[model samples]
Target: MPVDEAGAKAKGGRKRLIAIAVVAVGMLAGAGGVYWYTQRGSADHAGEKQAEAAAAEGEAEGGEGHGAADADPTASYIEVAPMMVNLRGGGAQAKFVKVRFIVVAAEGKTDAVKGRIPVILDALQPFLRELRPEDLNGSAAVFRIKEEMIRRSTAALGKGMVRDILIQDLIQQ
Candidate 1:
């Protein structure tokens, strides 16, 4: 039998080239998948480390219930401000609002959030002063201030540093 050597070699070379291309593409895809997985794993590990550090700090801060002297007794105190809320009009009688609340650090956070309380208070002072009894027409202005205080506390504390804002006394006159 006669053989077409040229055609045979061409077909074999084409098949070999196709096989090499397929293998290279698969390898590249696999490498890309591995890279993505590694990056995602690193990010998850970093988050876990942050969480662990936070938990450890919480454990260190009077969490073991060791001594009363070391405990944060100031956690009981609340700052207060008594201000008048003027309405939009000049003739209307303004309402007097007495506000008091305590802010505490979030879990595993230091007292640095307290240091920023001044900023939070500054944001609050104007908001409270500008309030109108009409604004509290729904009859829950105290709740509103508490919510705003928590939000401001969080902002001052860098997103999650404030645990809560306990409203100690709210008197509307």
Candidate 2:
């Protein structure tokens, strides 16, 4: 039997609404995928940048180590002579700086203090090894040792304390 015109119109209307719904669903899915793609790209870029920074820092540190290693361990010679510093008479101190010394080529004022190494080392080694923990606790302790070496050379040695006081190593021992 043939359908009436009203029935045919109703069927066409239903098909139209179904098409609109399907298109809307497809648009939503495509937009969501694009958003996810952009976010993934951003995350990947951030990770790459982090890796580059770490590599740069590592290279810098390696360069510094090589520069130090290439430096001459002895361009001059200053000996510690001997140390007789008393540690227990005052208090049981926790901070002590035991340093091995050598003489190095004078930089600016090394010549001015090269003669009194025997006298200066006599005063320096004992003094350095007797400092309390409070004395050797800061980052500036190395500078302090350098200054002390210079001062003692000027005070005990004529105007020269060998070439230069080279602190070979500083340890608590």
Report the poorest 10 consecutive residues by lDDT, candidate 2.
Answer: 61-70
Superposed model 2: Cα runs more than 4 Å off? 1-75, 81-96, 105-116, 160-163
TM-scores for every candidate against the unseen true structure: 0.46, 0.41
lDDT string, candidate 2, 33-100, tens digits:
99998788557645544443443333223332421312554434445543434332364433234455
lDDT (C-alpha, whole model) for all candidates: 0.57, 0.53
Winning model by lDDT: 1
Q: Show how many residue pairs clash in every candidate, following the order shown.
A: 0, 13
Task: For candidate 1, report its TM-score.
Answer: 0.46
lDDT of 1 at 121: 76
Candidate 1 displacement at residue 133 in angstroms = 0.9
Q: Write the per-residue lDDT of candidate 1 for residues 1-173, one digit (tens) a residue.
A: 13688889889999999999999999999999999987895676455444444443443343344212235554433343443444443534444665655565555554566566677777777777777645543324544566676776666556866655655545444
